[model samples]
Structures are given as structure tokens and as C-alpha cells.
Target: MKTLTEHDIRSSFVNCSKGEAKRLPLPKQLADIDHWDALDFLGWFDLSAPDRSYLVAERGDEVIGVTLRSPSAKRGFLRRSMCSLCLTSHPGSGVSLMSARKAGRAGREGNSVGLYICADLDCSLYVRGKKQPAPGGRMEESLTVEQQIERTRGHLDAFLERLFV
Candidate 1:
């Protein structure tokens, strides 16, 4: 993982709204962060929740950022009662609330862990894919855009595994 600055981290995002991304609290060790290892940073609103948190990871500063929100009592997505990170198909909609489970050695003593990912496919890149058509309307040829997205999803899954288990 390569190190990154708050500015670099903020500038890297392409999913969330610019205003919302800028408002997020920079990680305490932003200067020390490995931006290359970071897949991406995650941030959301706090209007009806506690303080906002940012999780950033990079793969040589060239991968999708993996982010998890801090634990909150309001239970935005967590209230769904499903694993937000899970995407397995179920008979009914399985929306689960994201819980901050303790991670690493610190998790044993009441550390934060887990988060609410879409029970279905992750909604981020999916939306992007749907909006953008293949170049020259060619579906057979592989494009850099498709490759980047595929790699990003792989990185996201790996990061979630590391954070959760």
C-alpha cells in the first residue's frame, strides 16, 4: 500500500457527490495512509446519526476504495437486518443493518466490525455499468473501463473479508 494525503484521497473518489465527499472527516492518519492500498473511501450523512467516519484503502493507489461507516444507534442500513455486504439472492429482500464489529486485535476489547452492504450486488459500480455503454457499442471486446471495474469489485470483496473475518 502506498501512502496518501487527505487531498489525494478526497480527489480520488468518483462515486459519491463532491459536496458530500468533501464534508467527510479525514482519517486521523491521513498523512500516513497507504493510498495505493486503499480501494476507496466511504462516507455518508449524519443528519439522523452520529459522527461520520471515513475508511480508505488503496492498492498501490490504483484500486477501488473500501470504506465502512462507524457504529450508530439510529440503524440506517443496519436496521434492514441483513448483511449489507452480502449479495446472495434470497426469496425475499434481505436488508440488514451494518454493525461495527471490532476489527484486528483491538476488536476483542469492544472494537468495531462489520457494515451494511447491499444484500444484492454492490450498488456502486452496478449503477455505473448500467449507465455507460461499451465503447463503439462493442460488447465483445474488453475495455479498460470494464477491467477497472472488475478489479475494483475484487478489491472490495477482499477488503470486506479482511475487515469482517
Candidate 2:
């Protein structure tokens, strides 16, 4: 992944109005995020609009972005939840049900897909051993770490593509 600027992020949005994209927040450490190798994509929540979030990932040379909505956490309800994107389980504060409105007119007509995603959108870091997975969060996997990372990125990329296609 290449280092992306705020402009890259803003212009990359495919599922939100320009005004909304302009208002979205960049990750606080974006400029200082030198460890691009540790990230499969970039995601962040807007502090002012807690319900709003965004994701951007580079596919080939193109940067793709999607706007997401953060539903209120259903705390203590689903005790053993796994993120649909990364397959990382969260016995505690590890996942949030995030939804993305479909792109173009379908979105305006109320089409969307919701999935349990890492609450902080830090799955890449977690998968790479940079961050600790919550207790009881680990899943049994025969795949090597590199293979798991590849699988996670594949799932995430395919999910993001759904908003546009």
C-alpha cells in the first residue's frame, strides 16, 4: 500500500456525497503512519459524527473508498462475534456492526450491507501481531500468518467492491 494523503482519501470516496466526504476525518496519525506495510487499508471514524466512518484501500494502482455507518454497539448481546471482513473474533470490545450504503441511486433508495467489523478498524495490525487480540478472540486457523493476511485483505476488498457494484 502506498501512503495516501487527505486528498487521496477525499477523492476516493465512491459511496457518499462530496459534502459528506469533505467532512470526513482522516486518521489522527495518518501523516505519521510510516508503517504502511503493517496496514492492509486505512479506516477511521469521524469524531464529530460518531455514526460516520470511512475506509480506503489500494487495489492495483487505484484507491477506493467507501463511506460506512456505525450502528450503536449491541454490547453484551453477541458475546462471541467475529468480524466478517477479517474473521477476527471479539469476545469483548472487538467488533461493531458497520454498514455501508450502496453506491449511487441505490444508496439513496436505502440499500445497504451490514457486517460485524473490527470496532477500531485495526484488523490489519491485529492480524500482523502488532496489536493484541481480545481474550477468547483467537480463531483456530491452519493458514499461515501471511495466508491469513491475504485472506483478510481479499475479504475486505471484495466487501468494499459491493458498495459500488
Candidate 3:
């Protein structure tokens, strides 16, 4: 994957208004993100960063397709008894926090860190009850939701590692 600039990302968006894309605050680390490894991004914008700042990504410029990530946080969503990715009922303590970014600068290098954790599971889709596709036929019989989540986590970890070293 090829890293993208704020301008590149904004231009790729098919649905959002140019004004909105331009106005959206670029992550101060915008130059720091590994835009290439990112999947079909819907959209991206900076999240306030002192303790933890994030860059939200979506399949389009619209809010409908989105994912939020914070390099500083290393934590995703909220803590829960179950795994949103796998839907496994862990003891609310088995979850993990993952973070990935470009290596040297946001886009200059590729490095990411992920921790097996028990943190808040606050993502809108996961919280509200939506399932993303796993590698198998379905989340039910094909592969456990936990496996799916792990798979994504692995992908993220690898991407991060690629960025890091």
C-alpha cells in the first residue's frame, strides 16, 4: 500500500464536499500516518491529541463507513466482557489495545504496537451490534468472531511492524 497525503485522501473521497475535507482538521501527525496500509478508508480526520489523539478512517468521505484509531491511545473502543471482533465472552479483561503508525514520521516510517488487553469497547459499530467480515465464510460457522478480531489485530500488528522497522 502507498501512503497518502491529506490532499491525496481528500481527492480520493467521492462523496464528501471538498470544503468539508479541506476544513476537517488534519491530524497534526497527518504527515505521520501510514495511509497506504490503511484499508478501504471511508474518511480520516484528526482526533484531539494530548493523552490520546486519533485519525478516523472511513470507506468514503461520509460518516457512514468509518473506523477510528489513536496512535497515542493504544486502546480502542471501551472495555467489555466480550470481544467485539470475535464476539467471544471474555471476562471483560481479555481485550487488547492496538496502535499502528508510519515508522519514522507519520508517513516516513512504518511501525505499530498492539497489546492484548481489556479496555473499553466503544466503537459505534461494535457497540451498536454490527459484524465485519472475517476471512472465512461467515462469523458463525466459518470462523469464530474472536478469530476474526484477532485476524484484524494481526493485520494491524503486521502493518505497524512494517512501519516501525
User: Which candidate order results from sorting by TM-score in descending order?
Assistant: 2, 1, 3
The positional error of residue 16 in candidate 1, measured at the CA in angstroms, is 1.6
Each model's C-alpha lDDT?
A: 0.42, 0.83, 0.38
Tens digits of per-residue lDDT, candidate 1, 1-165, equal: 345566766765433446755865665554553433322234333434343434444544353333245434343422224223222222223332344433445544555545544332233433234332223212332446546455545645564455545
Regions more than 4 Å wrong, model 1: 32-51, 59-63, 66-71, 74-155, 158-165
- How many clashes in candidate 2? 0
By lDDT, the best candidate is 2
Evaluate model 1: give its TM-score: 0.34
Better TM-score candidate (1, 2): 2
- lDDT: worst 10-residue window of model 3: 59-68
Q: Cα RMSD (Å) between model 3 and the true structure? A: 14.6
- When 1 and 3 are scored with lDDT, the better candidate is 1
C-alpha positional error of residue 156 in candidate 1 after TM-score superposition, expressed in Å: 3.0
